[model samples]
Structure formats: structure tokens, C-alpha cells
Target: MTRLGYQIPNFTYPGIAADQLFDTVVAQAREADASGFDTVLVMDHFYQLPILGTPDEPMIEAYTLLSALAQHTSKVRLSALVTGNTYRNPTLLAKTVTALDIVSGGRGQLGIGAGWYELEHDSLGYEFGTFTDRFEKLEEALQIILGMLDGKRPSLDGRRYKVSDALNVPAPLSKIPVMIGGGGEKKTLRMVAQYADESNLICAVEDIGRKLDALAAHCEALGRDRSEITVSLQTSACVAPTHDEAVADFEAYLQRNPAAEVRRAGTVVGDPDEVAARFADLLATGVDGVTVNAPANGHVPGRVGLLGQTLAPLIG
Candidate 1:
């Protein structure tokens, strides 16, 4: 079964210098590792996401940072929220993840999805095509990646990608888990049924049960057991000593990212008991794990620990 996870999406924190950016990230990752958070993730993008901060905000390349993080933390699994397939060739991405698994002592995960964030693609020289084109590319990419991870040389002649006896050496130390992040019922969920060890559902609180149902239907139609694919939720959360304090942290977060709008139904902010209550309800929706983002004060010394203390027991 999958376990609790944490995502560090934003690099720009108030009063933190650019040179000190990764130090802050390392702090959060280490804190989570010590606090029983089973996994830690970063976003795979060249630029800071608009939903998080301006493009010019301090953003490090995903795999490089995760590699550096592997040395600093001991137990938590490392990955991107979802690596954008368009950013790197499937073979190279597989090799990179394989190396991560080796260095982290086999605590690496590969979370991927069809690339989005058009602005980054346009500015960074990656091909930004139609939605259908991206999904088709992702499908072919996954085939290559999955095959390579299985220690098999793959030969493919597909529409978006082609390989003639492609090889990945030094395969992962363990069967590195593949997590697909998205909620597209037709394409994404179908891919989850086909290739994913886990699936991340980013939707409103009320919509979780509906998404789980959709995924189950996809699994059933594909002759895949739904239990084989662990379900995870990506939630924005803020936990503090008191309810009002947590809300203030969330509000402060909004001030930092003025363009961001908090999804009241999906966003969680409260004391430990309150946060635990929300986790209980989320668990009842059939989600096996959760990856939380507390962009506001996550870099603080004990904020991530508060989450571990509050909700880790509520999950399996």
C-alpha cells in the first residue's frame, strides 16, 4: 500500500534569498523525512508555475534537485509531482529515475503525466502541440519507460515516438513505483489502469468519490483490478496550533500568490484535530494516500511535523 506524501511546489518564500532557496527546500524535505512522511515530491518544470508564483521566481530543475535531496534525506521516496513527458525523451527520463533509485537506496518513485504549462513549453523550446498530440506522446513514452524499467530492451515504431532496440542499463534497484497524476477519465485513468502503480487525483473534496468511481470503472473495463492501483490525493493544506492560526497561514499564502485562488472544498486549514477530521473524510472516499502542499509555512521548522503528528495515523 502507498503512504502519506508531501509536495514542495514553490521555491520563492517570503524573505528567503535566491541563493538560500534550495537550503529552504532541503529543510522541508528533511523535516518531512523525519516526520513520517513517506514520500516527497517536486514539480517538474523549468519555470515557476503561474499558480504558485511568477515564471521568474526561483525554480530549480526537478531531477537535479531531487538527486541533491537524495543525499540529504534518508527514508522518504523522491519524485516529481508529475514529470512532463515533453520535457525529456522517455529513455533519458528512465535512466535518470533509475539513477535516482540507486542513490536513494531504492527510495525513488516516477510520477508522470502528459505535459501541460504551455508558457514553459513555448519559452523553453519544447514542442507544445494539441492536447491529443500530447496524450499520444505520453502513451508512447510510457510504453518505452515501462519496458525499460522492466529491464527489457524495447523496440517500438509508434506515431509520436520510435525506438529500435532501446536499452536502459543499471535498472532500478527495486521495482520503482510509477505514479500517474491526473483525473482525465477517458485518457488519464485508462493509462493508470494500464501502467500506473498509483494514481493521483487532484479534484474538489466532493469530487473524490466520483473520480475513484471513474477509475474503478476504467480498471474493470480494462480487466485490471482497482486495488492494484493505489489512489492518492494532492491537497493544499495549512496546519498550525489553532484553527485561526492555520487559516491565517493559508491567507498569508494567498497574499504571496495573489493570482492564486484557494479551492475551499479541496484546501484544508485548521488545528490537528480539524485536519485529522478532514483526512478521515478523504480516506472514506477510497483514497489510500495523500500528498499535501503547505506552501505558506512549510519551510518553517515544525509545520510539516504538525501534519505528520495530526494525520499520519488516520491513513493506512
Candidate 2:
């Protein structure tokens, strides 16, 4: 069955305080759990944009917030939308997941991707290598994570990372799901075919078919069943009592960020039934799940709640 998840906006909102944002997220998560949402995801970014509030705006750490979420909600999986590979060592990253899984009673999924924000890396003093180099590092990190999870003391010699006989004690209680993000037709899709248990893409109605076709081809090349990989899409959403009201809100959101055309695509805007039909169409494309990116702050909490409570039943 297809599942629905939420991507909590950790950035500040126009008139809301930082603490208020976090509280609202926790409240929404609780509501989602009660409303039968499958997972709650947080983005892995250090700074926020103007639409997301401000770059220097108050932001919370992804894993830290997730740890708190582990305590606050039950029956919902928790993860970062996609953790940047450059942010932490593979072994350390594995340990973090292991701990989160333990704390959340085996409801942790690690969503990781090749780092893209070069500005964050530069500001944080992380070595920002070429894109190809970053992919190489990500590939190595995947190997290390999988190896350690399999009870093997892994040793790796790679261009970006070199590790020898690394051990992760207290192995995860369950085989944590490994979700790889990005829809790059080449290396990223190849990696997903070879290793990832789940794969996520930014939803573009026109491009999704082609991307799915590419992923199927990659799976064929690796002799893997395409059915084994759970396909997911990340898209924005806004719901209200009527289509006009929701579309108006969505248009207002678009007005705030004219440059992010992609973000505006595949956005489900309407009443519960309309949103459910939109999501059902996406599910028909072999998408096993979706992560809905709600507007930052509590401005749209009721909309999110309505989606979880109303659309979820129809789609599920």
C-alpha cells in the first residue's frame, strides 16, 4: 500500500518565533501519528531562504530534532528528508541511526544524498569537492554503512574517505531502511538500483515518467527487481475548504519565491478529495509514497492536519 509522510519545515516563518515553529512541528507530528501518517521527515539544511523565512533565521539541527521527535510521537517513522553525505562520517552516521532506531523502537529510516549546497560546505569549512568527487564519497559511505550494518568490520580506501576496521556496536534492532534521494539518471539512479531500499525524487509531473523509466532500466542492469525499491516523491501541498482558497494560498506562496519553479510543481491544492485524487495519480506512477512539504510555521497547521485526517483515509 502507498504511504504518506510529512516534511516538517524547520525554518522560521514570517510572523512566528523560532520556538513556536518547533512546538508546532511537534504538535503536527503528534497529530499525524494519530491521523495515520507513515513518516515525518525533516530537511537537512543549516540555513533558510527568504521564502522559508531567512538564511540567518533560527534553524534546528536535523538529527537533534529527530531525537526529540522519537520521544514525542509514536507509530510514525522519522528521518531527515536526505542527510548530506559530507556532513558526517559514514560510521558516525550509522551510529546515529542505530541510536535513533533504538530510541524510536525501530522506526528510523536513513535518507541520505550527495551533498548539493556548496555554500553551506564553504561556510562550515568542509572540503567542497567537485560533484563527481562528492558522488564517489557518497558511494563509499554507502558501502561503509551497509557493511557495518551487516556485522562486518569494514575497511575502505577511497579518494574522499579512508577507514580501516571500523566497528559499530549495538547494531540496530531492526534492519533500518536506507533511502537514497535525488533523481539523477546516471550515478544516483545507478546507486539506488544497486544499494538503496528506497529512492526519492522531487515530483515533476512531466519528468516523473522518464525518471521512473530510467530507474527501471537501472534495476534491469543490476538484475534487481524494480518492485523491490520503494519509489517516493517530494512535493509541496496546500489544502483548504475549497479549491479556490487553497489555490489562492498556494499562489501567494509562489509569489514569495519566484525562482523556485520546481517547488511549485506537483503541489496538491484543493479540498480533501481533490488532494487525494492528485496523490492517487502520483501513486499510479509506481510511487510507493510521498513526502508533503507544508508551509513553514503554524500558518498552515490546520491544512496539514486536514490532509492527514481527510486525504490520508481516501488515499490509503
Q: What is the C-alpha lDDT of each candidate?
A: 0.88, 0.80
Return the TM-score for each candidate structure.
0.96, 0.91
lDDT of 1 by residue, 1-67 (tens): 2468999988878888888888899999998888889999999988987777789987788999999
In model 2, the runs with Cα more than 4 Å from the true position are 49-53, 244-262, 296-299, 314-316
Question: In terms of lDDT, which candidate is strongest?
Answer: 1
True lDDT of residue 234, candidate 1: 86
Worst 10 residues of 2 by lDDT: 257-266
lDDT by residue for model 2 over 43-144, one digit each (tens)? Answer: 887876444555676667889889899999988999888999999999999889888888999898899999988878888887779998899999999999
Q: Could you tell me the TM-score of candidate 1? A: 0.96
Error of 2 at 85 (Å): 0.4
